[model samples]
Target chain A: MTAVMETAGLGKQYGKRWALHDCSLAIPEGKVVGLVGPNGAGKTTLLQLAAGLLTPTAGTIEVLGGHPGSGPEQLGRVGFVAQDTPAYSRMSVSQHLRMGALLNSHWDDELAFRRIEALDIDPRQRAGSLSGGQRAQLALTLAIAKRPEVLLLDEPVASLDPLARREFLQVLMEVVAEHGVSVVLSSHLVADLERVCDYLVVLVASHIQVADDVAELLATHHRISGPRRDSRSLPADQHVIEESHTDRQTTLLIRTEQPILDPAWTTRPVTLEDIVLAYMGQARDQERARKSGLGVLR
Target chain B: MMRFAWLQFRNQAAVVFGGLAVVAVILAITGPHLVHLYDTTVATCAAHGNCSTATSVFLKNDHTLQILFDALVVVVPGIIGVFWGAPLVARELESGTFRLVWTQSVTRTRWIVLKLGVVGLASIVAAGLLGLMVTWWSSPMDRANASMYTAFDQRDLVPLGYAAFAFVLGVLCGVLIRRTLPAMGTTLVAFVATRLLVNHFVLPKLIAPTQRSFALNGVTVQGFGQMNGGPFTLFPANPNIPNAWFYSTQFVDRAGHPLSTQVLTSACPLLESGPGPSAPAGGGVESAVPAPGAGSALHDCIAKLAATYHEVVAFQPASRYWSFQWCELAIYLGVAVVLAGTCIWWVRRRLS
Candidate 1:
């Protein structure tokens, strides 16, 4: 019952800048994890580190109980769909399948062929000529054929149209149901994460703002409104992830393990999108404070 | 892995066939014609009153044409190397197809190693086959000519070695540059420049003397005076002239080889039984016929000249052909290994 992927204080750096900073999370087996973030939130960097495509700059990452890049065997167990669905343009659908068969120890050629056929891609048509959706589908087909224990998808459906996007997510769910493979998909679209993911981790400004089971998160996090007051007065366990004030009224999205017992404040459930927007605003406010050399948001 | 390599080879068959055909045709057609011309002209000129003029001109032209053709071998393979090697990985990276292969269970190291192994071996084979054709076609011309130190002969190990070097260099450049046009350009410039430098400078010093010296008119003799000097000069100006000479330095022996300056001088004393018996009486005239001290000069001269002689100076020795072939192959293959190792390191640590 080892965690499928575990990162201990992980950080990724390119030159002087950090792509992902102090990210510590454990994604257990058999769960679909959604890595949610705004632009440049280090989502792709985190996925790449988990998939062993990149080495962590500051800390360790383990995949299936060992170092991320242990060897081909570990790589075979962890399939990755890199951002933008980078398919070989000159190769035909059949060629990709051949490459999969050659490179993977657990290749499911029959499944790949069937999937490509179902997608209406001509086996002979070059990937270069395929539509964006078709290319993304083809890339997914290759990843699924490997039958990996863990799948790391970085913006897998970012390029597809709305209709294609829905179909791609549906296909992923069907595969997950049949194979029980652990998945970690990074995306900017909250709606996509909302429909398919059961586990969620929100990243903003290179920080992990929230990590929890989606059901538990939806069940507990609430928006509370009451008379204006300093945020420091809130209970220590009631963490306010984002707060806004307007002339004697204070609105806050607080993550709490216990039920709300106070009668003075009004509490309402918040959607994932609202939660993401709140985190983004908090990040922007912190950036402004740091630039002005003032501890305004303490 | 072999299948992938074969696929690459099949795709590039057109270039391989085209290059080989051009090399063959040029060698066959021009080779025999040059041989016939050399035989007829040198004999006619030797019979006529100017053997020196006939031989010198023939050798010069022979040297020029041979060097030019040998250079073609490098050019043809070079074109193939630049185009083939530069595009091998760049095309994959540029088109985003590399991710498909990279994500598979096979490590990046295996992918690059297999590609380089198969293609590199193919290059050596192609170069070896072309070398054989060139050797066969030019046998007659090589036998008749004597520009041992000229570019043609000096260029013997060149075509094969440079082709392999250029191909591997192209692969490395492609990986490092990660773009087609610039990789091809850099590889071509680097390969050609390195080759020219090696042939013209480093290699000559490795096995052959750099500045070869020989007296023109046999200066300083034992018994004979200047009149008996009989003026001797190098027929082809050593054939292996310095690469930078504007014209052959004709060492004008205007002083009719004086006896003290030329009568069996130490410059090129006749190979004989101990220093011409201290110059015989009666003008000390040594007959051209082979006698003890009489024959000793020519015999010893021939013996001394034997070591510098070559059976086939224009091409490498048959015995050492495979040795040179394998050595060049190893150099490029070794380079391919190093490049692949770098690629693995990048994939493992920095690829994202």
Candidate 2:
């Protein structure tokens, strides 16, 4: 199957500064892709570009085989939940669904109505009157009602409480399972993405730090703790990313293909959270180095 | 789109109906009563030879109404522009509802075009209906007293055209400015400026008299009572001149020079002024001057002489009522189209 979404050297510039830069990514069809980055990591910009809310200043972006800004048909295929959970305050929950029906060719009113009713949201309650969680749920309902081929959600559960977040992700997972629609969700919460996403893309300091299958990535990435040594001493296949050393010991987050053979080193499998933090640390260091023109990476 | 616009209209029906009903009631009650009272007074004066007093008071009332009509048109449309049109786009922008509409299967251009078209039609209809009603209500008075028909003077067509102009300008400002209060302010400023432009500059040029007539015949002319005469201005069909057909003097033969004066009179002295003997040959300069009031002895002699070789030359030009209407309408319509076009262009190019 064709890649449902693809970006090649896609960068967005706000004046002289880059919001997202040098991003190249491709996610194949039928996979739940998670975009993990810290705040202002250009995650939202990337998602907005993919969703056609913004134009990329450099390079190319495609959503579901067509260009990102292909307009209504491409837009109809892609459903975006912006960070604000934007909705018409005057419209009722049912009216929002009605608006979705009017705007989308493949509107699934039954699914929307069912989800709203199950959530116990009164059809007549105005969107402005809804609680934060309820409004998030309503926004999700509107996004899902379109039955879009590619759903691009930017931090859908960012503001929700733990319970609401879990429930929200659970419903998303259920919907994707039933429809097999490709979803690209951006979030800083790696644990949630680990539970629900099949694929992962880590963006750090305006660059793609990593992109791989979540399960595969977790399997290969290992944290090796040992006595201090120069990174040049490691084998060529081992990519040591975030290295911290005490006088006695060195703990390195490394991506390696082979199991550790050193007797002095203790190696353990890394969690998704651990991998994400490693990337985050690398991003901060890179940003600091770029700002100050210091060579911290050898 | 029409359905949606109608929905908007229905939602604000209370405001629309309430305002219209109140104004209508005031017009219905006060308009006819004032008109009738003026008519009765005119009739009473006509029977009692006290036409001057009744004419003055009734004409003043009519003038007041003329100014009121102009003011009324501006205020109503300004209200609609500020309240309805400013919020038309601002409310959506403020609530972020336009994103929902904009991101849909429909094109943004189509969405805006539909909305503007519907609202524009509604605005025009409302203005047209109101204009028709006012025109009907004031018809009897307009006929009875032509001077009271100050529609041309006050730029009445501008207000009708301005309602739409104001509405469109408000919506455009709303979308471009993206803030409700600022948009309302801009709309008010724009409407007021255009109205003032029409009233002060364009209307005057359109209706201002260009040629003045220089004679008054078969009438009791009054109130140029203190003309030692250098250059006196005359109003054609002067209200102060009763049954007096008035005209203006382009030039007069005075002091052996063709000096110019717009002064209306019973006569002009028919000879040259020179340093000659008291009865200089062929200098037939009269020592006599006409009495000031109507039906005086000297006034009769001058009227007879003026009748013999009557030549009424214009000192100022003449202008028509509809000329003012058309010119003012053209100006206002031009503004409307430019504004509407700007609105369309901005929405298409910069709206997002």
Candidate 3:
């Protein structure tokens, strides 16, 4: 299958600081990809780069086999919902729908009106007065009704309440089920991604830590705990991701294709959150090591 | 795209055009009455030999409306720059809605072009209509006033170009600044400054002024006074040039050299040399009353001065009014086109 997005050495800078730097990824088609990172980890920057809302300072990015936002054709294939779900405050909901239809050649007017009607949002109400969930829904309606091949959302549910976030995810899942559009959505909350993401990309400190199919990531990564020991003693095939030791016990998160043959450790399946946090912690440690001019500990 | 542009612009258009409609109505009703008054009074005042009185009375007929229309014409372009142009792109950037609109099937180039084109054209049209109405309505008063260059900035064709330039300038500021309020402020200041600079510095220099010499015949001599016992000075009245932009008037000899105080003191020795009783103290020049029997002597002195010297007046004649209007319009429109090109280029390449 063709990749929905491909990047090589992608970097973006603002003044002296890099918002996203030296990043690379090949997100495949048709999966709900989760871009998980901490706040200010350049998730929004990466999404904007893909949506063609920003220009990379260092390298190239392509969406759907073409330069992102290169022309009307390329722009028509991808939908973007920026963070905060901005809408014209004074414009009515119906007017926003009209704008979407007017600007998009392949707009699905029926689907848009259907979604708006099913959501119980008043078509005449100004966008500024809508609740956060409704606004997100409206923005989602606009993006989806464009009939794009891919959708890029930057933290769409980051500001919504728990119930609103759930509802938003539900609507998104329905749209994905109905249209089968490839989606890449960023979020800081692991639980939110855990529910909807089939593929995972963990980002931290302006860099990508790991990106892979969720099932493959889960199958390769394992949490093992045993008697206290140095991490250097682990088998060569097992790549240690994170390690913590107490006085009498050692806990390690490892990624390897091989099974544990010695049976001296208790192995358990890790949740998506566990894998995300382990990667995030490992990246943070590497950054700290680089900053302090010290070698990686163990 | 055009429809979308119109949709976005219609509300603001309605507000401005609605106000214009009201103005048009008032001008339509009062315009004919004004023309009638001018025809009955000022137009025939030449035969009655009371033209000054007739013109003043006709000009006073709708003094408030005259001021209102002139002020409106002057201010509307700036208002369009601030309220219409500044917010065109800046508001979208400020509110993060550019992401929504630009990502649609439209290229950013097309989007910005349509937005600027639609609104910019509307600004020009609105200003043109305002200029046309005001020019037509004030024709009577303008004819009576007999000076086309007095309120030059607020008159025909120039306001249209000003509106175009101001609107584009505001768009450029908005694109570069990426914020609404600051762009609006900058547009207003820049628009006003450009208009003033062009009016005071650039417009007059566009064409070299015409210089004419007027023989000093039967004209009043303003005063004769010695300054700090240095030289006796003559202050001659300015030459009359109707409906012309007078730049300067100076007393010059036949060779165009300026007359010296020594020549004036020697040639008109009948005039007092020191600060006479009629002259104000501190060596200032006041209208010196002639000594009771010195009228013939004064006339002879003026004739002698006229034989050697004449008044040179620098001015722009009334016939050049339309040419100046066209020149100014072309200049502003040209700058506006350059600014518009810069805006498009910036929006395409630099903005993000």
lDDT of 1 by residue, A31-93 (tens): 899998887999988887777667788988898897775678988998888888887676777
DockQ of 2: 0.35
TM-score of chain A of each: 0.94, 0.95, 0.97
Where in model 3 is the C-alpha error above 4 Å?
A: A294-298, B220-232, B272-298
Candidate 3 clashes between residue pairs 3 or more apart in a chain or in different chains: none
Candidate 1: residue B44 lDDT (0-100): 70
lDDT of 2 by residue, A230-279 (tens): 87799888998889989988999998878888888898878889998898
Please identify which of the two predictions, 1 or 2, would achieve the higher TM-score against the true structure.
2
Name the lDDT value of residue B84 in candidate 1: 72
DockQ of all predictions against the true structure, Cα-based: 0.45, 0.35, 0.84
User: How do all models score by TM-score?
Assistant: 0.77, 0.79, 0.95
Give candidate 2 regions above 4 Å deviation: A258-264, A294-298, B1-9, B21-70, B152-157, B202-210, B216-320, B323-327
Best-matching candidate per DockQ: 3
The order of the candidates by lDDT, greatest first, is: 3, 2, 1
* Fraction of native Cα contacts reproduced by each candidate: 0.58, 0.35, 0.88
Candidate 2 lDDT score at position A292: 73
Docking class of 3: high
